[model samples]
Target: MDTIASLFSFITWPVSWVIVQFHKLYGAIFGPDTGWAWGLSIVSLVVLIRICLIPLFVKQIKATRNMQALQPKMKAIQERYKSDKQRQSEEMMKLYKETGTNPLSSCLPILAQSPFFFALYHVLSKIASGDKIGALNQQLVDSAREAHIFGAPIAAKFMDTPEKVEALNASLTDVRIVTAVMIVLMSASQFFTQRQLMMKNVDLTVKTPYMQQQKMLMYIFPVIFAVMGINFPVGVLVYWLTTNVWTMGQQMYVINQNPTPGSKAQDAYLQRLLKSVTQHGEVRGRGRKRVVKDIVAKGSDRNENERRFFAGLAKAGFAAQADGTVVKSDTVSAEAEGGAGTRRQQPKRQTKAQRQAAAAQQAKEAEDATLSVEATPEDKPAPSLEKGPKPQAKGAKPGAQDAADKPARPSRANSGGARQGKSGQRKGPQRPKHPSSKK
Candidate 1:
C-alpha cells in the first residue's frame, strides 16, 4: 500500500494542503488533536473533490446518452464490416467523431480522482510512519498520529501490529474494530448504489448477459471493497467511506430527477410529472416540457411508462401535442391505443347451405331429446284419452242399458268393493262375501 501511495507523490502537496485547510476550520470546533478534527477533515476533502468533479459527471451522463443514441448506426456499421475488424473500428471512430462523443468521458470522474486519492493515501501512510510528507510537516504528522478515532489513531490500520498500534497510542483491538466498521459501511454504500442503478436507473425490459453480469457485479463489488479496505489507513478509510456515501446520494438524486429513458426511475419521475401537469393544466417546468416533446417524438417507440403517461393525459380530456403542449381535444390520443397493435381473430365464414345443414342437425337433436324424455316411465300412468262403451249386463240389462247414466240408482262399483278404480286396479278392500260373492 505504501509503495502504491508513493507512486502518486506528485499530487501529495495539493491533497495534503486541502486536508490541512479543512482541518484548520474543523480544529477550531473540535480540538486540533481530536479524532473529529482529523476525521472530518478527510470527509470534507472528499466532498470538495466531488463538487469539483460535477462537470465531469454531467459530461459522462451526456456522453452515455449520445452513445445510446448512436447504437443503431454503430450496429449497422458492425454488420457492414463484421468480417473486417479494422474497417469496423474505422467506421466506429468516424461515427463517434461525427457525433462529437468521447467514450472515455464515462470514466473521467474516476480517472480524475485517482491522483488525489493516492496522494491522500500517501499522506496518511506518512502520518502512520511518523515521517513528514508534503504539507504534513513533523508537527502536523505528530498531531495526526496522536488523534484517535474511537481509541484508534487516524493513521492506524486494521493490519498494523499490536506493538505499532501501542506506539501510536491505540490498541490493536480498537484499530481493527474501527477499520472493520468503516470497511463494512463503505462496502455497503457501494453495493446499495450499484443495486439502485441496476434496479431503477437501467432499462430492464430486455434480458441480456450484460445485465446478468451487472447483477453479479452488484454482489462482487462489495466483497472486493471489503477485501481492499482492511489495508487502508483509518484516514484513507474515512475518505473512501465518505465518497461512497456521496456517490450513493448523488445517484439517488439522479434517479429521482433525470433517470435514463425507458427505466423504472423514469417511469416514476414521469408519473409524478403527469400528476402535476394534470393538476395544473400544463407542464410546470422547461425541463419537463422538453421531456414531453421527446416522448411525443418517440410515438410508438415510447416505453410502456411513456404510453401510460399519454393514457393519463387522454383520460383527462387532454391531448399531447408535438410541441410538448397539452390541449383540451375531444379526440382520443393516438398514443393511448389500447392493444391496437394486436389483431383480433375472426371466425371462419360459412356458406348458406352449410348454415342450413347446421340448423337441421340442431332441430333433429332437439326432436330426439324430446322423444327420449317422453318415453321415460312415470310413477303413474297418464289418463287414457280413448273412450269406450261400458260393459252391459248379460240378460236384458242392455235394454236397461244406461244404468251408468241412472243417477237415482246407487252404483255397486261405488260401494268400494272389488271394482275397477280410475287407475284400472282394485283400489278398495273387498270382503269375500259369505259364499254369495262367489255366486
Candidate 2:
C-alpha cells in the first residue's frame, strides 16, 4: 500500500510543484498585494496555459469532427452486420484505422488536465485553511498575506475578516461573503461554459449514446465541483472562473472562425449570417423573391390545393377505399360476379361428357341429402363418407343386391350403336372376322 501511495505521489508531485510555482510567479509579477491583482494574475495564468494548449485543442477538435463525420458510415457498418458481432468488431477496427481518428479524442483534453486540476485544488485548500503559510516561500507568503482589495483579504481564512487585521474586527459583520459569491460564480461559469460547448460546438454526427453519456458527465462534474467549491479558497475560485471564461472565449473564437462543417452552431450561424451575405452580394434582394416565385410556378400550390380538395372529400366520407379488398356493391348488377350468394354464369359450350359428369355429381349429392333426412334419431353418429361405402339394407340380397347396388352403367345399345357408327366412318372396307364364316 505504501508502495502504491509512493507511486501516486511521484506522479502527483510534479503537478503540485507546477501549480505552486505558477501561483507564486503570478503573485510576484502582478504584485499580489491586492485581491484584484491576484485575481488578474490568476486570469493571466489561465490565458497563458490555454494559449499554450491551443494547438492540442485544435487537433482534438479536428479529431472530434472527423469522428462525427464517420458516424453515418459507422451506422451503415453496424446495420450491415447487425447480427454478426465478430464481423462488426473487425469492421469497426478497420474503420478506425482508415479514418485515423479515435472516438476517445474528445476526452483527451480533460484527461490531460485532470492532474493539474487536482493539484490546483490541493494548493487552494492549503491556502484556504491557512496551514501552509510557512511551507510557501517567505517572500511569496508575505505578499499573499498583504493582498487585499475591496476591503477583502485574498489569503484570508474562510472566517477571517479584514477588520481583524485592521483592528476593526468588532465592527465587521462578515468577510466570507465575497468568497462564497466567487465560489458560486466559479461553479456556475464552469457549468455554463461546458454547456455552451456541448450545445454549440459539438458535431451533430456524434452518436446519440455517446452524446447522452457526455451530457450525463456535463451535469455530474459541475455538481461535484460546486460541492467541492465551498471548501476551496477564494483564490481557487478566481482561478477556476478565469479558466472557464478563457475556455468559453476560446471556444467561441474557434466556432465562429473555424467551426466544423455540419456542427450545430455552424449550421445555425451559416443559415443566419452567411445566407444573408450571399444573398445581398449575389442576388441584390431579388434572389429570395425569385426563388419563391419559381417554387410557386412549379405547381406545388396547385398540388396542395388538390390535396386539400381530396382531404375535404375524405372528411365528408366520399373517399374510395383502395386497400386491396374487393368491395361488394348493394345493387344487383353492381355486385361482383363471384361474391357470396352470386353464382358465376358459365359459358354454354361444355362437352356432353362434362355435362353428364356434373349431372351425376349433383344427383349423388341429392341422394346423400335424402338419405340423411331418412336416417333415424338413433343413427345420430354417421360414418364419414371418406371412410368407405355405406352398409347395405338388411332385407337386401347379398350378390344380387350388390350387383343391383352398383353404379348404373351407360346403355349397351347406345354404346354399341355409337361404336358401329364410328367403325362405319373409318376410311377402309370391313373384313370378315373368321374364314369359316366367310366360306
Candidate 3:
C-alpha cells in the first residue's frame, strides 16, 4: 500500500491541492466546521474531473462502436486461427490498428479515474490519521478535523482509535450509520450505472470476449465497492458517490441523444420519436450544440385538434376505405358531409375589407330605394277615366254643350250681345257669379 501510494504521489499532490481549494471556497460559505463544505469540495473535484473526461467519454463510445463493428471479423479470425493462438493475437492487434480502435479504450474512462480515486482515498486516510499530506497545511488539517457532517467528522472513519473516537464524541453506531448509508448509495449507484450501460449501450448481437468482460465488470464493480466503501472515509465515499452519479447522468444523456445502434436505447429512442410524431404534428432533430426546434410534419400540417377530429370520425364509423373514399352508410355519410354530426363547424371569418365593402353596398341600396319611393309620388301621371265638363261661354247655361252644336243663350252674361257682334262678343265665365260679386 505504501509503494502504491508513493507511486501516485505526483497525482496525489495535485488532486489534494485542488480539493483543498474547493474546500476553502465552499467552507467560506458553509463554515469551516461544517461537513457540508468538505462534502461539496469532493463534489467539486468530481465535476472538474468529469468535465475534463468529456472528450474521453465521447472517444470511448466511438471506440466501443468500432469494436462492435469488428466483432464478426474478430470471430472469423479466431475461427481461422483456432489452432494457432499466437496468430490469432497478432491478427487481433492488426485489426485494432487498422480500424484505429483500441480494445482498452472502452475502459479508459474508468482506468483514467482510478489514479484520482486512489489518490483521494490516500489523502483522506492520512487526514483521518491526523497526518498532514499533500497540500494539506496544518491549519487546513486542524479545520478538517473540526468539520463534522451530521456530527460525524469528515475525516472520521468506520474504524477509529478509542482516543480519536472519544475526541470527536463519535460512537461506533454513528460511524456505522453514516458509512453504511454511503456504502449502500455508492454500491447501488455503481450497480445501476453499469447495468444501464449493459442494457442500453451495449450491442448484444455478437457475444465477444469484450462483451463477456463488460458483463463481468458490471457485477464485479458494485460488489467490490460495497465491500470497500465501508473502509472509506466519508469524504472519499462522498467523492466516489458523486463521481458515480455524474457518470450515470452523462451516460444517460449520451445514450439518449446518440445511442448505440441496434441497442435497447436506440429502439426506445425511435419509439419515442415515433410517438412524438404520432401525437404531435411536429418533430425536430439535434442541431448545432444539440439545439432542437420543431419542424412541421408532412402532408396537411394538421394540428393535434384536427388529428383528434379525424380520429373521432374514424371512431364514429366514418373511416376512409382503401380507395381513400369515406366508407359509411348514407345516413352517416350525409351527417358527415352535411356537417350536421358532432363534427364542429369552423365559421368563416370575413376580413375588414370585405365587411366595409358589404356595409357600403347596403347603404347605397337603402339610399336608392328611398329616392325611388319619393320620386314615384312626383313623376307618376294622374289617374284618368274620362274628361269632366268644361266651362261654357259667357251667356251659356251651367250645363251647356259645345258651341259648335248647342244654341247661344241671351242672358245677362251676353246682355251686350246686340251691341257686340258675334266676332267681337264679350266672353265671361259660363257659370253665374256669386250674389255679392254680381255687379
Candidate 4:
C-alpha cells in the first residue's frame, strides 16, 4: 500500500495544498486541532476534486449509456466469433472505433480520482507516523494527527495496530467503530448509486449482457469498497464517503432531469412534463420543450411510455406541436374523451362457403313459404280459378276470402305501349308485318 501510494507521490503536493486550504476555513469555525476541522478538510478536498472531474463524469455517463446501447450488437459479435477470440477482440475494437466509444471512459472519474485519493492516504499515513509531508508542515501535521473524528484519530485506520492507534492517542475500538461506520456508509452509498442507475435510468426493456454486467458490478463494487475500506485512514474514508455521496446526488439529478429514452426515469420525467403541460397548457421550460420535441419527432415510433405521455396530453385538451409547444386542441381532446372515431361494428366478412350456405338457407326459407301458401285448404273459398267469383256460399260476402293476401305491386306509367315487366325490360308497341312482325 505504501509503495502504491508512493507511486502517486507526484500528486501529493497538490492534494495536500487543497486539504490545508480547506482546513484553514473549517479551523476558523471548529478548532484547528479538532476532528470537524480535519475531517471536513478531507471532505472538501473530495468535493474539489470531484468538481474538477465533472467533465470526466459526464463522459463516463455518455460512455455507459453508449455501452448499454451497443450491448446487443456486442453480444451478436461474441456469438458469431466465439471460437475465435482474436477475431472477436478485433471486431469489438472495430465496433468501439466506429461508435467512438471508449469502454474505459466509464472508469474515468475513478481513474482520475485515484491519484488524489492515494496522495491523501499517503499524507494521512505520514501524519499518523509523526512525519511532515507536502504542504502540511510539522505544526499542521501535529494538529491533524491530534484531530479525532467521532473519538477516532483522523489518521487512524480500522486495521491499524493497537500500539500504533495508542501512539495516535486513540483506542483501537474507537478507530474501528468510526472507520467501520464510514466504510459502511461509503459502501452503501456506492451500492445505492449503482442500484438506482440499474433500476430507474437504464432501458429496462432491453435484456443485454451490459445489464448483466451492471448487475454484477452493483454487488461487486460495495464488497470491494468494504474490503479495501479496512485499511483506509479515517480521513481517506471521509474523502471516499463524500465522493460517493456527491456521485449519488449527481446521478440522481441526471436521472431526474435527462434520463435515457424508454427508461423509468424518462417515464417519470415525461409524466411530470405532462402534468405541468396540463396545468399550464404549454411547455414551460426549454428542457421540457426539448423533451416534447423529441417525443413529437418520434411520432408513431414512440415507446409505450412516450405514447402514454402523448395520450395524457391529448386527453387533457392539448396537442404537442412539432416546435415542442403544447396547444389547446379540442379535436384531439374530444376524440380522446368521447372516442368519436370509435371503430364501426362492421359485419364479419364471410368466406365463399359461408356465403353459399347463407344463400341456400334463404332459398329454402322462400320455398317453404311458397309451399305453405299453396297447401292451404279450399274450405271457405270465395274466388274461383277462372278469375271469377266463387258461387256464393251460405250468404258469405263475394270477395271476402280473396281480400288482399299479399302487398300490391306498384302501378306502371301509361307509356301507350305494352307495359314493361317489373324486371324493367321494355315491351314497345307493335305495328303490322315488319312493323307488322311486331303485331
Q: Among these predicted structures, which one has the highest lDDT?
A: 4
Q: Which stretch of 10 consecutive residues in model 4 shows the poorest summed lDDT?
A: 430-439
Higher-lDDT candidate of 2 and 4: 4
Give TM per candidate. Answer: 0.73, 0.50, 0.62, 0.78
Give a tens-digit lDDT track for model 2, residues 27-112.
Answer: 57665555555566556656666677777787788776776667778889999999999999999999999989877777676666
Q: Is candidate 1 or candidate 3 better by TM-score?
A: 1
Record all residue pairs in model 4 with backbone atoms less than 3 Å apart, i.e. clashing: 432-435, 432-436, 433-436, 433-437
lDDT of 3: 0.74
- TM-score head-to-head 2 vs 4, winner: 4
Q: In candidate 1, what are the lDDT values of residues 1-439, reduced to their tens digit?
A: 6788788999999899988999899999999999999999999999999999999999987886676667667778888999999999999999999999998997798899988889998888888889998888899999999998888898888998989999998888888989999999999999999899889987766544456766898999999989999988998899999989998999899899899888899999988988887799888778888888999999889889899888888877688788888887665644345445555767799999999999999999999999998885679888898677667767755547666655665367556654456676567755556965557
On residues 287-399, what C-alpha lDDT tens digit does candidate 3 reach at each position? 31121111122225543433443444433445433332334445554565666556777889999999999999999999999998887565788899867876667886755
lDDT of 1 at 331: 58
Candidate 3 residues lying further than 4 Å off, grouped into runs, are 161-163, 207-209, 275-283, 287-439
Q: Number of clashes in every candidate structure?
A: 0, 0, 0, 4
